[model samples]
Target: MNTYLQVAAADASEHRTLIITLFSVFVAATLGVTVWAGRRTKDATDYYAGGRSFSGFQNGLAISGDYMSAASFLGIAGAISLFGYDGFLYSIGFLVAWLVALLLVAEPLRNSGRFTMGDVLAYRMRQRPVRTAAGVSTIVVSIFYLLAQMVGAGALVALLLGVSGDAGKNVIVVLVGVVMILYVTIGGMKGTTWVQMIKACLLIAGTLLITFLVMLKFDFNISTLLGAAAENSGQGAAFLEPGLKYGVSTTTEIDFISLGLALVLGTAGLPHILIRFYTVPTARAARKSVIWAIGIIGAFYLMTIALGFGAAALLSRKEITESDAAGNTAAPLLAQNIGGGADSAGGAILLAVICAVAFATILAVVAGLTLASSSSFAHDLYANVIRKGKASDREEVKAARVSSILIGGVAIVLGIFAGKLNVAFLVALAFAVAASANLPTILYSLFWKRFNTTGSLWSIYGGLSSSVLLVVFSPVVSGNPSAMFPGADFQWFPLNNPGLVSIPLGFLLGWLGTVVSKNEDVDGRKYAELEVRSLTGTGAH
Candidate 1:
């Protein structure tokens, strides 16, 4: 890794030129899209849901882009390069999670929701309290996820600039925060969707190209490639097995299960992903979008195996560890090596392009997250809750813009303080929160006739509080030598992820609160109406 860094330093001038040129082109293209989108964004509907005009396929691409964050593109590959099969586990969990979204959440969410996940949750419940709870959940999840993306942006930018300091990273975080705020506040969902679509195309194309090049080196032989990867990994056949990273002990095995549960349930609850459903005109369109997203996202993850193994096979683990210690640089370094080493024209160009793609991935995702957070704040909190649903369209849009600025500012501050924390782990924590806090409430609202305002509030607050508290006390926070704060060992929780406990707890809280509260026939009637609409798409937005 030091050797690679030394080589990068030696060719800093060329790398700088290439990066600048690629970044300039990327910025120009995305900026043009934002301007065009801004022109079309007139009313609150346009700002929040792209006027509900996006085609299923287009929305699908955007969904893929939103789901496949820098963590998926770079962090997973890096994990695989370092940890082997355990890394691929994340890919499987992410893909399977879409099944939950498609079959259970997509059409119903689209049929009942207007602008945010909070919309759907508050549809049959007391509007103000439910929306307020959901608004808080949305903001919390978005902030955590946004912090991860911004930190990743900082790290990727620092790598590309060949700079090694907090100052450089802080600058990058601020720049990303500003760009994301601009994307959301100016162009809204229309601009954000287009940016995501473009980025997804580039991301898929780049991944395919890298996979093809790697296969070409092994004569397109799968067996040969696997053999080489296993041999080169220094763990021999063990590298191809599952227990190398995640299943070594009883505690780790439980943690792995918790992580898997979170990933599988989280997608349906994520505000950014859920809001994509509202971008389409019909429930059928939303369902179709999920199918398309599944296809694209599945293919992307399938190819990641090759990317990960290729990195392990071609580059020594020691060098990769030396490079960044977390293997986040593995993919870029692999591109550099397989394209012809850092000094060669092919290597330099490939590295620059990959860096640009990484930047786009971060920018697009952060924009979507900022939009989701802002929409929840403005639509659910400001417009509906505080204003009693009397806020004008223009007022709501203005609120969304202000919320975007505030959210971006908060993310920048958190990212600066986070400083080099693992992106994948942070993302998993976000998922755990979403699963624990939002998914249960959403499920009950859509399917349970007895669910009331009290149930919804309890579920949201209970799940949110439990997940956050558990994570803070879990091994990820402290106790172990590898904890984020190794010096403070206050961890009493056993698992790295709280989903195993918190998800069930969320459901239990909802059920208990509902059963214990006084019965409301009005809520029952509302659920009956919601049931019909959710099933048949009548009166749906």
Candidate 2:
């Protein structure tokens, strides 16, 4: 078996042609869709909200595609393959976060928001300051998240195309960046939505097929597969337990909790996900979309268990570890093995299909991130804050297109430098920032009658700054051998994730800022109007 894998590993170059072919097909199809959507996207409403035309089912699939990025598919599967049950926890946390989005955010956001999250947040507050704060939070979270996707794209290109060195990775990053910029600038919301919907279907189908194949190998018995995975893991039964990855010490346990908090709260504040609600016509459509998203996302996560454990059971640890230290290549390698070893025809086909799906995954996610960031800049900052809500629709749309190009350029540059950083950790940091900075302000603005512009601004800045600073000083950045800068020793912060501390601080700052302000009575008087609008969809754009 080892010799077979060795021969398969040596034959990777033979698979490159297949990978290129499938990737070309995917890019061509998506670009065609973008062209069609671009022709129809004439104004700000069409660019940002798809003219509020998506049905619940279509938006639901698009939401699933947007949420399930390369991190969810490749990252989680890789984590589970490398660390066992601890990796499965990420899937659980991500699925649970949708519940927060559905129950707490979806309907109200759809009712109050138009083009961006700032619309909902600044509805009752002073528009300029509030929109500026929301815009900053949106850009911060979107950029962090976009960096992870871009990094993943580089790694995937290197693996699939049999390329090596920084030059190859840089070329791949530029290609991804250019494609994503076009997707957002041309396709806008309508184009991006259809792209997401198509990708979602492909991803779900590919995952299902792979899961079914893995099950067939195990005689359709899940317990048998788990036992085999444990035996192959070399940790005996312990590999099936939670302590393998995240339970090293008291600090690690706290880190796990912090990560959980961020994952659960983050979805409600992700600007791209929030904006999906506005693509639908009404609050009811938004609620229905969340339900559809939860169903699709939950099913996808459940199947990831099969993909992860199947790789563990069927492939040697050394083979998976040596291919990519972070285990990002696990799923594709597993597919190659399961389809009959790398040298076989079936193996090459399966590998190419999975690679295409992964490529589509990154494309859909980065496009959504670009749209969210650009829309926040154009709609919140340029239109509302700078233009005092006097900008023409054409001007706002043009600004959004320009912003997309700038954001995509930044992501490409950062991704080239980021190299092979663990995509999962980058995603977690992005979530923590969203939970800390955006969630508190959103919750208070919608539910707290005393919440004012001062409170919202404080919450956004406090959460954003605290999360970034803590992450900079945390063990993830330095001190630990695996840290980004292993030679540096600036790890004063113990926890890798900052959610446990920063989330509470964000809420505290919001409350304190509101109480210290003199506009309490004035803000309170507006609550009745806000409440009526939020619940009844009155005066909503």
Candidate 3:
């Protein structure tokens, strides 16, 4: 018995070798791709939008890779594993948000802009101010999203390697931040796109394999799987119902509505997603890309159902919670269980492989986010706003590289501070900020002729400030055990998300700022031209 137990313990402790080996292999492969892509990045066009050379299908896969972030893979799976029906609601909201993007944002955005959202917003307004607002907002929103990715990286690596201290996780977070900076600085858009596409494929394959094993175990019956999950959840029938996570209180119900609004509207405004539209050569390709992304992303979320419930059914709640109290490790744990349990070689190999795929997902995602923000800073703030559009291509690209390092540094610092938060919930806060600030300004610029620079400034600044301020004073920051600082009780805002109040206020401020300002004759002419270009792709880069 002692000899047998010794072998098992040896295997358990040494599994991290497999994880490190897999992670290093992926990192080396992606870095090779980055060096290759870096050679082709010759100018602003190449660096910013991959020279508009990507096909609809290629960009589609890249879009799916960028969209299905750690929040989707790790956080949503964890949420569903713990909360059942209410957790699945996140999947529905995320999928539906693509329709909003397709119908309202994608084609027009592709036609109207060159690199950043500022290219479109500054098209009709005063170039400097609008671009400045856009640059600031892009950095803020991308940082919020970046925090979630970093946190996931730290958690996944530390948990799989059995590192028990915050110091190890903190070190991993710094390493991830450094890697993301290298990707953006070295490869630009072409390298980032290829990394995303590869990661997307690996993530999908891993999820599918685990999902298939899960379905086979349950005899391919979803209802049977769900029933078992509920029974195992200890909440019985309540586990399969809507009130398990939300709707328990009136405040909770309203919070759900707020979250729904944010998720539904947020994708259209996200800086990284908006930038994806520019990767394709034309508006038609952009639309095609969105269609492909929706199908792939939709299928992925559907399989999340299997992964989540499968974890709930196969593992005890105590087991899931004990692995990572926030359930962040649920997916890997499920992979381990489905691969013949932890004592077996299959379990260790499967765990390491899935986590490596997840690590790939994190690296690709952070690269995209960093690229978006750095591009905004270089193109909008440094080149256009500060230099008055006279900065040369070499100078602009240099600025973007410098800014990527700085932004990555800031993300590393903030991520360590918010390391304990749920990745999905952190992403929701990002969505709320994007929807409240960027979406209102984008719609006004595209559809409303009377919209002026005053309106744009009011919308972006008002929306950004209000949403951020509310979150700072909300329960998410204090007065709750799960808050960033639970020891303090300074929360004054009631909602967990600020979308309910901030989104409407953004629209109202834009309208109010517009009707009160003098409508310029030059503005009307610019709007007419912008309308033609936005609709018909005339003068598109």
Candidate 4:
């Protein structure tokens, strides 16, 4: 049979039909809830911040939904399928990052600001340059991250739905974008939170089901699974070990370090994640949300290991191998191979659920990202800077809605252009940028009293510039330099990830900027009061 014909025939099976039906139901319910919640939003603050009414638990679940992208769902699974134990490094690194968010950043961030991370940083300092810099960084990071998710969503839907060519992906972009915009514009934070929470539960349950079933296939004996996997691949238990390669070079070490830095530090900097902190009413609630988020996220990552390994063990090597040698399609393909072909009722249902969840994940993140971007542009840029704080809350909210439409459109266009790029790789790039640009300044502002606004600006600029430049030179960026200057394909950086280099530079620049501006500081007492209030909530606006 022709390969394309086989794929087309497999997709037309009864199992694929079941999967499609199940997925439609799940997504429809999610959209309904989001639209219902949207009706309560009346003003800008209500829309962007969900009226500051959510408790920590709700916010935390939503945060988990936001954090677990298609990369986590599909990319991690694919990585494990291809690299054995080495792929697990991604899960471990991602889980540990929450420790930073829970222990160091959460409470302080929630207590200090309103809409964007910039709001917190600029609360006590001179607003002009700092706010503008933060606004720019948030949009840039959000755009990069959004692109990866959108691309992943499109591909996942296409693969699961059996849609030929780009049609499925394009449909997904419209579906997800429209649903998410309704979630934000109509229900605001309240609606988005509920949708996210539900989606999180569904995602966790689905992953757990896949993991449990995979283990059951081996009589619940992990050792049996591991042995089979090793024998099949001839890599032994080392397939379950850290590092993708046995003998790592200096360059490889640097790359690993860079990847780790992004995973560890980027959690706090993500715009969607940061905006989540503002949903809960109190600083303590924000702290509690992080604690809950860590537990949920940790549990999900643990399951990813099972799914990835299961894919490697169950699927035929020929069928499981990715076109790019990356193992991206292993999970879904393995499911079809084992649970019954795409024609099997069970397989189709599973496929549909996975596809819907993928769609939901992208939508939730984009809504949050759009909210963050719009809030920064509308509240930080237009309201704070352009209007000199004269704009009413109503005007700010309207501007945010408009921004959402614009950003969502751009995301749709980018998603189409992104085509077949492995989403896991793109997500890593976003993480690198977030860690380099956003984390250092946030940490310094909350912990270092001597930190001045000028230092914050320097850190943001330096970090943003370095990360973007490094990514531009990486293989992924070099592969398509249509967006860059002619003949700039030369890569200055050896590693694909720039977190290790750029994150430190941000911290250093922030420190230096603080020292230089410390002498000319105005309003030390006022600054101290703001810090005190942020921690204790006595002087909160």
TM-score of each: 0.97, 0.97, 0.97, 0.92
Clash number for candidate 4: 12
lDDT for 499 in candidate 4 is 86
Residue-level lDDT of model 3, residues 1-541, one tens digit each, is: 2432244335558786777788899999999999999999999899999999999999999999999999999989888999998888889988999998999999998999899999999998889999999999999999999999988998888767766567988999999999999999999999999999999999999999999999999999999999999999998999898988787899989999999999999999999999999999888999999999999999999999998899999988877766566677789889988998878889889988999999999999999999999999999999999999999999999999999999999999998877777788889999999999999999999999899999999999999999999999999889987787888999999998999999999899989988888775444898898889888888868
Candidate 1 residues 35-82, lDDT tens each? 899999999999999999999999999999999998888788888998
- What are the RMSD figures for all models against the true structure? 1.5, 1.7, 2.3, 2.9
- Runs in model 3 lying further than 4 Å from the true structure: 1-12, 521-523
Q: Deviation in angstroms for 441 in model 2?
A: 0.7
User: What C-alpha lDDT do the candidate models reach, one value each?
Assistant: 0.88, 0.88, 0.91, 0.76
Error of 1 at 100 (Å): 0.5
Candidates sorted by lDDT, descending order?
3, 1, 2, 4
Q: Which residue runs of candidate 4 sit more than 4 Å off their true CA positions?
A: 1-9, 13-20, 164-175, 234-238, 245-248, 322-326, 479-488, 518-523
Assess candidate 3 and give its lDDT: 0.91
User: RMSD in Å for candidate 4, one decimal?
Assistant: 2.9
**Model 1 segments more than 4 A misplaced:** 480-483
The CA lDDT at 124 in model 2 is: 76
**Model 1 clash pairs?**
none
